[model samples]
Target: MSEIISLAAANQHLQYIDPGTGNSSGISEMLAPSACLNAAEKKLAFLYLDNSVSSIAAFWNFFNSNHACALLSSSMKQEFKDSLETLYQPHFIYDIKRESVDGYTMEKINSSLEIFISRISSGYSVHDELKILLSTSGTTGSPKFVKLSEKNLVSNTKSILEYLPVQSSDVTPLNLPIHYSYGLSVFITNSVKGGKIICTTKDILQREFWSDFEKYQCTSLAGVPYVYETLFRTGFTKKKFISLKYMTQAGGKLNEKLVDVFSQFAEDHNVRFFIMYGQTEATARMSFLAPEYLQQKKMSIGKAIAGGRFEVDPVLHELLYFGENVFGGYAESWKDLNSYRQELPLHTGDMATVDAAGFYFITGRIKRIVKLFGNRINLDEIEKVLNEQFHDSSFICTGLEDQVLLVGVKNFQDDEKIISHFLHSKFSIHPSVIRIKQVEHIPLTDNQKVNYTKFMEQHGD
Candidate 1:
């Protein structure tokens, strides 16, 4: 067992608080009822979790047990959820949202949570070292899962803690979904401090979220680029949260202008603002820019996390990371779970360059390039250009071998001509190859990332 999980399970000072009901329960007490699961042999369990105490308690219950668990979102579509259930054939299905599965008998753990036990054996052997399975596709419900072991989780947790200042007296809110890698790391890292964790489904846009945050005196916050954008538009910089000591951003890159704005805000308010870089394959974080360097290196991802090293491929210029936290491997089916692949020297698909001081900056994704008229055009660069130009709109840029498909969301459909003129003026690309479409809302993956794959599928024909 990992030391972090063991510490959390045994710590009586660690409490999971439900802000909705103002109820609090110690970790030992919350995890006590599910001790029967630990008696079982090595098996596979599917955990559909949310941001509530019952769901988190159920997760810790299975995590501490010998069984390997797959973390999934509770709000996943029924068909997609059923597809995964059919594909994996897990022996146990612990669901917080659904009532039952077709081939499984439901057993209630609490009023809001239940475990479905399979009627027949799955006849599949799960590797002993596999601790957790996280989906690579955010909300797309892809069959692929990144396998993580106890070592990956613990190493990554310790690396993040080496830079983050989490105290036992601090209060952290579970605003992000635990099914996502970033959210899971936040939960595990804070658990080590044995502090009060506020479990709620409320987001920053909700009035209830602020009420609970102020009520509990929450000390820190974390979000992705979109969350920060919403915060900036909603006047977050003007308001003062007396208890906020630090903020962290990851999941995807934030615009350089926004980074500067937040950096200045953090300076003015005496709060630490961290710009982090990570992926699900690394078990959460790979690098973090120290708050002190935000002003000087606003575009850099800073140095690698503790116990990790970063290098760029000389030939391909792709970012490469070597760390104990690299995932075991990817599993797409039941048979894939039988063997654990300890693949190392993770190859991040993004092209990056490291400076003399060792700070890393991602130029673009290697796969996000389109060739048109004998010129290689970066799709990510195009999207960034359009997004920065049109402050009120978001754009998704995708393309084939020689054509570019640009999809705009929010009041920019007729700006196609303007976009074409700009691209022609900027990149010297012909206007005939560029096509634009308008949509009310851009599709997002389960983790709230821009669904570029879906966009390409919809518009790249």
Candidate 2:
């Protein structure tokens, strides 16, 4: 039997409000389509979802049923989405944008959504423990996915709730997408134990988003580093939201200066600020710097989560994590789903150091090193230096070749020659090998991380 989440009890107190349409509904309403997905046969379903009532209902139905599903963004490109469908050949597909599938019959779930039921099976069996498949490459639509089990989800959720201060009366806006790991955790943690959830597609930059945030009196805000950066640049910290009790940051390392700025703001306002660290491989979170120690240990990733532990490889200095939430390996094709392979003691690929208090600091990425002119360079370090120097701009560094490095900058007003000159003067990097590309905004994957893959493609690399 599947370890399905029974909403019978949670439904009584769970209230879902969609600010877009001014609609308020109970969790029980999400169960209306449960029968369509609860068929006795075990199958795989593809759920392309957005933050909306219908999408939530479909996702809950598939999750509660015995079926295994892959959660994808509804905004995925049609060709990329079609490619995955052809590769996995899922038995069912729920997409807000799709009208029909080649060998499937369509059922209209709502005005904005439809369900596609395949006419024939793909002749593949899904592992009993496989419950969710999250894309490894985010919006790039790579076939690689991290496989997660029900135990992984439950364990991570419990661990997060242990440290995150959320209450039954709190209200939170779904500021992030549901497909991203951090975003999914925000939704699940709030749904299972927190309080009322406001479902909206509006992002932080939109005026309508702030309007809804104020109208609903959102109690908590969750964001990645990019989101936080945008908030700080937009004078968000200067303003006050009385309903906001706390804030959560993850997805990437926020600059130390900005971390201190936000920590001080949170302190003055009596709001808790949690700096967390994790990857999709570990479900969502592996560690979090507690609000109490934010000022003293602003650079630390803090201690391990409630049930997770971290270790640094003696030789490589790479960060390692051990926990129930560690994913059951990865899936690149449908055939790989035949069984679950637990690749434990996850090497996080990040080089880190731990202090006497057991607090961890991420130094750099092991894979981010590149050879340029017989000198090894760390791309992450270059980015950190440039970002700190050019506080008004954002920089992403990538080595394209043995002697060539590309620096992608956004919101930069200075001459490109200045960047090259600075690199040559400071790092002894020759100007001939330094390439600079400026953009109005740095391209971000659907999950809101720097889209290095897309950025590289822009240069035809």
Candidate 3:
């Protein structure tokens, strides 16, 4: 691979913190050192392998100026990778270091960015109209992607900035992964206002993380249900973030009890806690429970953003959204990447009900997929993983909206605690969201099919 530029030489658009030292220079508007793709402003698309601070810096280097890019998790399985390679045929793949990359042309842009190009042309067109490609519900294995345009990204970013005003003086930690849309939006919105970001991979459970959080006087933090639960268990009340002004939550429904607790905490500390609702297709967020309505509409996902509004389907109970942020649609293969106009007022697969005050509440998902800690866990995919791990034992997987997973296993010898822990560490499922139950047997109907309804009814705990 030819070396294009070293990180030390790249432009510095924003001053980032040292992950180990927690030190950062003030925000700088100077163009961050970035490489110009050979095909500047061309209707080209490339693969982005996961979140690396530097790679993202390189991405912003050209996101709007150069070419459209598709973001993917680096840890995707091979079979899925092969299928995707056949679909969009990303002109280049960005990663940290070089390895076997399906024999694509490799080039080193800098310490944080590596690019691999395809040798043979694939008969697919990444339409000039397409901008960003995001995975649907964080499913790396799924071939389908959400197609977003420049208008979608900028409009959503502006709406969020309007509600959660930021400043150049503010210092926010990069608390979420860059590959995740929620986390990525934080980076984009903060950048739009020229706010400083304390980028680190530190976990909340770590003492060093807290020390760094305080050292920089970080202004805000973001998390999912699992993160807040960890904070509660680890004594979030006693700990003090003197400079912290606000926090945000999404990805999954928060328990009603925790909502009351966090709302009170915000009041006592004079901080803001934003409860939000969104999907990948919405380009990140569609609605949020404003701090003012936290107590009155405790569970409502507040009214739509500035230029958007939503309606509930009386019969299907699906949330229908009319907004500029709605994505172009789904793309499963290269053939599906053509320029297709998106009609306003889209159907969100989430089943919901609206309150008298015009606020929306998500009651359940229209499908069986469960959103846990911002990750999508398919019951069938999870069951397949469990079956491979728990040999000589059988289990059942059932999923629903706004609830934890219920895993039922028969003839199990492992302790329940161990089972939940394994699911958390191995499958990335939060321990609090997974419950292992000892069942008599896998529930079945007279037709010899797995009776998911009867099984959940009997074993759900």
Candidate 4:
């Protein structure tokens, strides 16, 4: 490291704020790892935390080192979690205090994480190339994980910093959880630049969240397409703010209608709105629609990030990404991570087409999985669940370009209600976006397999 860079890094700080109870903490980036992370068992560990400061502090100390971390979400299904326990057996686990919701007691919420971790007996061995393990949005209840190395993280983070012009003076409230790649990317990109991250567990809906935002002088906010929906509904535009320098939208595509709204809003306020696109496999981001061409390009995933390249497959038209940030591969458990291959120009599994202006537009999913607000859910996985639960019922699941999933269930009692409840309880998907339709029968091809195209054509709303 440069002497100047080292001197400035020494002055950098990390602040975490709790909007609910109004508690806060400050931790240094250079703090030593906990005693739990000794040489003997420092190979792999699981990291789960909300946007809490203590957790973030612990994360920097433990996760941002030689000991690779398997980032797991609390919202993930138990089946997937169990599979991870069997697969890449996390040598040790580090999770913070789970945020208390309206119904759960404080004690219940806090103890929940510990109770769950205690259930795991032993973990499998992690691979050498596995510097970081990230779950692929719980798609299909399959133990699909994007295995990233230190090179992937560093390369991608540097690219993000290069474009965003991140600075040590900048402050961002850690509104997004660390488990999500998008959220963790913000933490890594900001931290590397010696910037401040104000960790918080407060919901964006709460007034206290904004209050803390103002108090901490938060310079930027990041969210998925769904968050923009609520942001407008909450009258976020009416609020006055002097500090917010930029806003980034990723996780999934934000439709043109909202894009127009955000584009104009950001311009009027003199704040940049970056429409970005990426996959967890690329270590976080591969492309971002530059703020200048946001209106002209309109809904394009834009061009590749610095040092990254993407090409469309001639036959499948699936997007394939090439970059140092592209992951080694996926890991279902410790054994899978045992030997990692360098995957360059990784086939992204998303169908797409390139614009004349060099922008990329994702058209459809060739992979049975669809990402909902950045979480990947396999249509087949949903079908498998329904089959296990209902013998007399037949089900086919499909998703729209915008990620709103559709389930066509035939011969099921209270089909909508039953399926909606099951999806919510099992997958943590809300019924609001899930459209349940009563179908006479699932469309099938000559081979007797469910014809997804025909099913969508016949019953898609």
How high is the CA lDDT of each candidate model? 0.82, 0.82, 0.72, 0.73
Q: Which candidate is the best by lDDT?
A: 1
Per-residue C-alpha lDDT of model 3 across residues 325-393, encoded as one tens digit per residue: 888988877667776578777787788888777888888776667777668776776777778888778
Q: For model 2, how does the per-residue alpha-carbon lDDT over 53-73 read when each residue is reduced to its tens digit? A: 778878877787777899998
Model 3: ten consecutive residues of lowest lDDT: 1-10
**TM-score list, all predictions:** 0.81, 0.80, 0.81, 0.86
Evaluated at residue 423, the lDDT of candidate 3 is: 70
Cα deviation of 189, candidate 1, in Å: 0.2
Consecutive 10-residue window with the lowest summed lDDT within model 2: 1-10
* Ten contiguous residues with the weakest lDDT in model 1: 369-378
Model 1 per-residue lDDT at 256: 82
* Residue-wise C-alpha lDDT for candidate 1, range 263-339, written one tens digit per residue: 98899988999999988899999999999999788789889999999999999999999999999889998888987
lDDT tens readout by residue for model 4, 44-161:
7666555665566556555535567777665555565556655655655554434322222222112212212333334444555567778787433457778887778878888998
Candidate 2 vs. true structure, TM-score = 0.80
Sorting all predicted structures by lDDT, with the top scorer first, yields 1, 2, 4, 3
lDDT score for residue 106 of model 4: 25
